[model samples]
Target: MAASLTLHPDRALPLDREQRAVAREIYGQTAHLPLICMHGHVEAEVLASNTAFADPARLLVTPDHYVTRMLVSQGIAPETLGVRRVDGGPTETDSRAIWKTFCANWKLYRGTPSRYWLEHELVEVFGVDQVPSAESADALYDRISERIAEPGFRPQQLLDTFNIELISTTDPAGSDLAHHAGLARQGLGERVVPTFRPDAVVHLDRPSWRDDVAALAKVSGTGTGDYAGFLDALRERRAAFAAAGGLATDHGHLLADTTPLEPAEAAAIYDQALAGTVTADQAARFAAHMLYVFAGMSCDDGLVMQIHPGVLRDHHAGIAAKHGPDVGFDIPFAAEFTTALRPMLQTYGHDPRFRAILFTLDETVYSRELAPLAGAYPSLRLGAPWWFLDTPGGMQRFRETAVDTAGFYNTSGFVDDTRAFASIPARHDLSRRVDAGFLARLVLEHRLNLDEATETAVDLAYNLPKIAYQRRI
Candidate 1:
């Protein structure tokens, strides 16, 4: 017999009786507030096309690195999970086989946040009642496939059902943004906007850097033969994004260094990079200098700058070579923000127009480096726990560590930086429950009154994201 699946309403609340009661009350106040997803990887075309999802495997397994990476760690091959290979290698073509493999390994997710989100999506979103396992895999697959084929299961309908007030999609610097434009034609533009991410053109060490620069020049109608022309092209592209409702720019670098270079030095490095004569040290210097340039552009353009540094992307060389980027091998390293960001902070930390949100995979920096920086700099705001640290325990630790120094206003609220569309509500719900529990503990300790806790819960869930991202809507 298959075990029945259930999701308790008070799943993530505190264990103490008094605190749990307070948490329940606090959660009730903000649980239904619409989600404000300021940063995510969901493509705009998925919603613009408004197409019905293909199957359970494609919907839940293949696109989610969180799920696939776990399976890979357990010695299951990516081909079995239907992840396409860059080398045109054979992958599982049958959806049912992929679904069965995922279901069989469902128990591997024990005590994981992925398990919580996946279960919430299954029970609450899809009305799935039976626990996923080898025995029930086929039945669950058929049921989910049938539901997806229904008109109500389309992407746009799901977004409406999720009660998402606003969401942003990350786009490369050279993107044409036709999908975003298409959303506007369908009267859904305000709800979904683009975010400028220029890593491809900014990172000189990437193999495709020259191609990306050429594409940027073509799109922005500027020549890239000179360093000044490249800067002008980036400025023009930022303006284009702003005109199309973009509110933020995202930077993902290996380090948080933002040192600037003199014009002659910067131009020489750029020339070396373009001529394929740049050393690794020169490339690192150029990337750091570009971070400073990105800040200056954000200050002039009013687009909130979001820096997520410290990720050593594609850690597994073999996996990365076989399957392209985002195959879930990214690892975190120790990050030092105070000294690394001193140059940029000194230049624009006091500028009223400059707003920068900082995120780190290194939790060690939260209380020591990040909180102190955000507490003092008017333009700096600490981004929520992100990537590997976006779990319930991680969020709890974040509140405890940074709240005293940075306070609630100096921190950006939950952004749901996810690629999985179905898990948005679940992720946000988890954050809300964890936050309510944190706030309730303060109330139980007599540190905060009930009224103040309620207001702060609402701010953490909804209001702070809008203010931090400068989202007018």
Candidate 2:
């Protein structure tokens, strides 16, 4: 007999009886509250079309780097998992075979946060009764296939069912946002929104930088033949995103450097880049300067700025060359923020309209740099544990290291920054549970009363992201 798939109600609560009881009370207060997913990678077209998901593997496995990365690490080929190759190489087109392979290797995810999320998606989201294993793979796949085919399982309908009060999809700076307009026609515009991401055009070292800049010029109706025109084009695109209900800008620079450049030097570097003669040092300086420019723009327009740096994206050239980017070989390195962001913060850290949420992959800086920096800056709030650091233990560690210095309010609430649509609730639920445990410890330690903990729990789970992203209700 297959192991029955069951989710314990008190899965992540504190182990001690008294603390567990307190955590239970705190979790209950916000467990079913509406989700405010202010930052993620879900495409607007997915919800705008309101189409039924294609299949279990395509919906769950193929698009999620978190899952694919682990499977690849364990000797499973990406092609066998149905991940397409850029060279049009052969891959497993059979979704059922991919599902079976995933199940056979399910044990590889033991003790991982991915396990928690997958189990939640199975039991709670799709109503699966048996745990996924080699014996149960086909049955689970067919069950999920049938469920997704149901009319009520459409993405837009699931948004209501998931209680997502608001969700933001990351879009290129030059996007026309036609899908966003379609969502508006369906009355989902206010709830399903867009976020401006200009990395492709802002980073001078990319191979396609010239082409992206050209596209940006065409979309913004502003020339990018010079530094001034490029900045103008970016500003125009920002305005268009804001008009379409965007509230934040996302930047994923390799470093957190925010030094401004002299106008003449910046212009010369821009000309060199346009002429395909810019050196690596000049490119790095130009990228750093753009961060400062983006911050000033945010201060002027009231769009919250989100910076997540220190990721060495596409660690393996062979995989990246074959699969293109985001097939999950990214690695994180140490990051220095205090010195790196000094110039920008010194200029706008106190600006009333400027709000920057900072994320890091380097946990060592949480207490030493990020906590102190966020604790002091009026314009800065530490974003939740991101990317590789969004695990259960990582979330708990963030509170332990950050709360004493930065406090709860100085930190933005949880963001389910995922491309797997079915994993959003699982991610949020994990965050809420970890937070409840942390707050319960505080309550027991006499640092906070139960009433205070309850209110703060609600804020962390629902209210903080809304306020951080400048969303009302």
Candidate 3:
């Protein structure tokens, strides 16, 4: 017999009776607030077409690197989980087999955020009543597949069901944003917006950098022979994104360095990069310089700037080469924001027109570096704990450490930062529960009254992200 699945109503509440009651009250005030997903990796085309999702394996197992990476760590191949290989290698083509593999190894995800999100998706989103196991995998698969085929389970319909007020999809700098335009025609533009992501064009060390630059020139209708023209092209693209209802720009750099180089020096480095003669040091320096340039552009324009630094992406070259990037090999390194961001912060930290939300994977920096920096700079806001640190314990640590220095207002509230569309509500719901528990503890400690905690819960859930992302709607 398959075990029955149940989501305890008080799953993340405080253990103490008095504190749990306060948490429940606080949670009640923010439970149903509309989600404001300021930054994520979901494609606009999915919603633009409102297409029905594929089978359960494709929808749930394949695209989630968090799930596949865990399975891979336990000696299961990613291709066996339905991940396509870039080298045309043989992979498991059967979706049912993939589902069975995932279901068989479900226990590996215990105490993981991925498990929490997956359980919430299965129970709340798909209405599945049986826990996943090797024995029940096929039956669960058929049930989810049937439900996904229905019109009410389409992408756009799910967005409404999830109560996503405003969601942003990351787009390459050279993208035409045709899907965004199409959504506008379909009258869904205001609900979904594009985010300007220029990593491919800015990171000169990537093997595809030149090809991406060529594509940027083609789309921006600008010359790439000179640095000035390249900057102009990027500026033009940002403007186009703004016209398409974009509110922010996202940068995923290995480091948070914002040191600026002289224009001639920057131009020389760009020329070397274009000539295929730029050294690794030159590439790093140029990328750092471009970060400063991006901040200046954000100040000139009004797009909120988000920096997610300190990730060593594609940590395993063999896996990356075979399966492509974002296959869950990215690892975090210690980040030093105090010195790395000094140049840009000194330049724009006090500028009212400029806004930056900084995310770090390094937990050690919360109290020592990031919180103090955010406390000092009016333009800087601490982003929520992200990537590897988005778990329940990580969220609790973030609140405990950063709240003392930066306080609630200096932080940008929860952002899902996900590619898995169905996990958005689950992620946000987890955040709300975690925040309510944290606030409840504060009330229990006599640091705050119930009324204050209640209002702050609403702010953390809904108001802060809207204000921080600069979303008009």
Q: Residue 324: error of model 2 in Å? A: 0.2
Writing each residue's lDDT as its tens digit, candidate 2 over 1-473 gives 99999999998888999999999999999899999998799999999999999999999888988898899998899999999999999999999999898888888889889999999999999999998899999999999999999999999999988999999999998898999999999998899999999999878878989999999999999999999999999999998988899999999999999999998899999999999998989999999999999999998788899999999999999999999988999999998999999999999998888999999999999999999999999899999999888899999999999998999999889988899999999999999999999999999999999999999999999989988889211
Point out where model 3 deviates above 4 Å: 471-473
Clashing pairs in 3: none
- What are the models' TM-scores? 0.99, 0.99, 0.99
Instruction: Tell me the TM-score of model 3.
Output: 0.99
lDDT score of residue 367 within candidate 3: 97
